[model samples]
Target: MDIRDLLLELARTYDEGKGTSSGVHAQDLLRRAGEEWRHLLPAGFDAEGNGGSGGASRTPWIGVYDPDITRDPKKGLYLAYIFAADLSTVTLTLQQGVTSLQAKLGEGEKRRRYLQSRAKQLRAGLAKDLVEGWDARPDFKCDVLRARSYEAGSVAARTYDTAAMPTEISLREDLWHMAEVLQHAAAVERNLRDEMASSGLPVTKRVEGEEEEHAGLDGFRPKDGSDYYVLIRQRKIKKSRSHEVLVRLFGEYIEERGFVPITKKMHPKDIVLRRDGVEWMVEAKTVKRGNPTKAVREALGQLYEYSHFLYEEQGKGEPFLLALFTEDIKAYAPYLEKRGIASVWKTVEGWAGSPMAVAWGMVDEQ
Candidate 1:
């Protein structure tokens, strides 16, 4: 059968059963798919008693799940093709089931490093082979199972819609163009394996009943508010004159000039400065990477919320909400400015920008 016939058959499965799957229907669909494109499919189907979904109550869609490796439900992989009821659309999905298991490899700094590096690698690989109309989810529901899905993993999916019945040539071209999305998902799995091998951290076998750690940054939000502080405690920032060192430098810059600066005294903020009849709340974030993307975003949130907490203690005065980034983030300056927050970008030598940018009249008054 050609691509057109496969599409028609998928539609028939959905139309006939209306998303209610039985063992017989599942076996039949698997047989048809295996017969159609056995050469192009990935591994794990060659073994004795290859696996397929028995049946599912999949509303609005009829689907087949072919597990290449299902020995470990949390760490294997699958290729899925499900057609919607209308016969006008179908979705192809590829996912790595072990992603959540990998993300929780270690407890602290080591895990953070692994997650950050792995995120970068997966993002790069997906972008490298991504196709049109396909949207990439970098975190892809790692540990959390959404109500819509059956398992957790890295997933890249896209839908193809045919306004009318597609001709053989049209279906073939359509399949070829969309095949890259599955390849993209497969590439993500490969990148993750590379990340794991190169990490060199001591691998600990997971204990049963262990909870999975969700990768921060879905998965964009930074995990721990105390991470930068943990670096401070470990003295890892002392030997290296990195962005993290700027936290103490900038805090001293405030205090040495007669402003009283306190660390963690304010709620949800790294530092708070008080003097001259005004309070200046600051969130200090440092990154060792090229761009302080997640750090800066998290800092903005902390500083904004800290301002409110300070207001509860004090009053609704035009106090300063400041964000200090160790990297050059002039592009993000406008965003911080719009929120009336003054931003300071630190260079290896020193810093720039003053809280007076908010026009609070405190600069001259002080």
Candidate 2:
């Protein structure tokens, strides 16, 4: 039998079985046969070769045997043998031996076209809705109106049909309007709070319109509208420079402890924290479950450089700490340790809770 015919037969057998053990075996055999054929063929044949028995034997082929999509209840498996004239990619039309399969393929193409046309219509309708909606609204303000004016004056609006104009113009206008409105609202709230703070009254008490809730205001507001002096005391106690979540946690643990943990303003890569009044360099690393790549190794090297800088250049006689924070500690711990690098693994607890360590490093002896 011809090599191509043999491959097709194997694919057909596999397809009839619907991916059973025999089907998988057939597939493996077909793959090996293809690989062997490619090895025998000259490399230049793929680029451009003469049309002869050797070239005919080297027809590009893929064997697929799976459950038929067209068959009622999809009984016995079917095999698909696709052949191309050249090694370069080509679409095969299976016009013979699989009439139902061909019909299904045609149906699929039609459905795809239908879906594409429907998507275009939906997009056009959405664009129209946005423009008409914004124009209809009397309260639209700021950069939105400015952008709309520009869009309305553009060449596309004048030259193209209503459906052909880009949808982005409407979207940009709506987004700009929303941004301006939100900015105004925020400004109003901030002004109100500042004014209340100056008037010796709690901002929470002066409920002029809707109450504005700012971050870190929880547990700071007093039940009774007490003197602004009382509110100020609470505010000072709760305020911290870090993220609100971090601030709240630090507030509960470190407040009144006299341990003024200075929040480093510099990048983690640049900042070096001091221990015992001496410059102590620490490298912070965060990793997920995947094996460390070359990028990770580079980052680790960068951290090492930062540590060396602190010790040699700054003359801060303190040990370095390599803090490795990871979700999966067990998987990465061994890998990191193999590199002779000491690491601290921290597991995050619930929100606003402290991170619990599966294992941590002692002060680096090196």
Candidate 3:
């Protein structure tokens, strides 16, 4: 069934009374809806729906989970579609898990307060622009305790009134948007954990919403044109160990070639090579799973920004732009070349570069 049809069906047929024909029908619709939602997701994601147990639930929902984030709704983050207790509205939300929180604080008003506070932090850590259209503070108007907790746990949401239900395309778009937000959150959490581990810092329980602590970024503050500023404001928050290593290794390679590589603390670009009045602004990114496209894209943006602000804005001639990666970004090589930016990546034999880089003597043809 179409998403709107499924939602409308559940809203109209959902019976408050237990064991009623309509109640059974609602449960079946929810199950089928879950399967349909599951088909819309990518390989690593799974969708499931809960229409209530024994009796109809006050707020039925279909949740999408990434195992890398958390399978259970008791902890970690996920995207879900929750119908109001009265079924007057359905909300698509990126929400936190609250069951574990209640387990710690016990049920009552204290738990409710903590849930909202945690939700605030979750919202704070993510870039506001990423989920721009969603409401940061949404009221689900649920009567039951569990449903109320879900409302308090919401990070961001978009509510649709049943009377003015959304089109199928709109519903799918919202679902995909929330999915991207969840993916971005998982990457941030992963980077934070990696940063902590590399520094020998104990990885604290992330389930409790304490994941924003930046132990690895101690003594580091944001500065315009610096990595810290770009990372924090642009949602590239933490630098992984591999990223650091790649930069260091590339610097050494440049030094051996009789060029001076400016440290990041002294400059905005990852590695700025200088010798004989020539400068090459090199931005390095470590590719994960051999997919260098995301890294390449980020490097491209940073490269242009740093070049404009640090050099051109000050009347300095535009520096040679180079996009460096941990793996081959060959697919983007021609694209970068068209824009007069060179491409380079790590290889088993040594460093490899695009034709422009080769002609510029950044690396020999290989």
Root-mean-square deviation per candidate:
21.9, 25.9, 15.9
1-366: candidate 1 lDDT, tens digit per residue: 554566565555543343334445533554555456432221112211112234333322222223322333344444444444345665554444333444555334554444344433444555544443554332222232221232222244555564456566554344333333443443344434432354566332222233233242232232343443333233322222223345566676656567787875343355677887778777776532234577678777766654554454345674678777655566677777887777765432234554453253322211
Residue pairs with colliding backbones in model 3 are none
Q: Best to worst by lDDT, what's the order?
A: 3, 1, 2
Query: Rank by TM-score, descending?
Result: 3, 1, 2
Candidate number with the higher lDDT (1 or 2): 1
Candidate 1 residue 333 Cα shift, in angstroms, is 1.2
Candidate 2 lDDT by residue in tens digits, 1-366: 333334344434433223323235554455455343331211101111111122122222332211111111121111122322222221111111212322332324332332233222322323342323232111112233221222221111111122233243332233223222222322232323212345343222113455344454455544432333345333533221212222233323322333233345533332344435633233433332122343246436755654554344456453443433322234444555554444443222211111211222132122
Per-residue CA lDDT of candidate 3, range 168-278, in tens? 877866765676677666655453321234544323323433334436435546555455445543443365545666777677776887788897564445788888989
lDDT of each: 0.46, 0.30, 0.71
- State model 3's lDDT: 0.71
Candidate 2, number of clashes:
3
TM-score of each: 0.33, 0.24, 0.53
Q: Which candidate is the best by TM-score?
A: 3
Higher-lDDT candidate of 1 and 3: 3
Give the poorly placed runs of model 2, Cα more than 4 Å off. Answer: 1-280, 293-296, 329-331, 335-340, 346-366
Model 1, global lDDT:
0.46
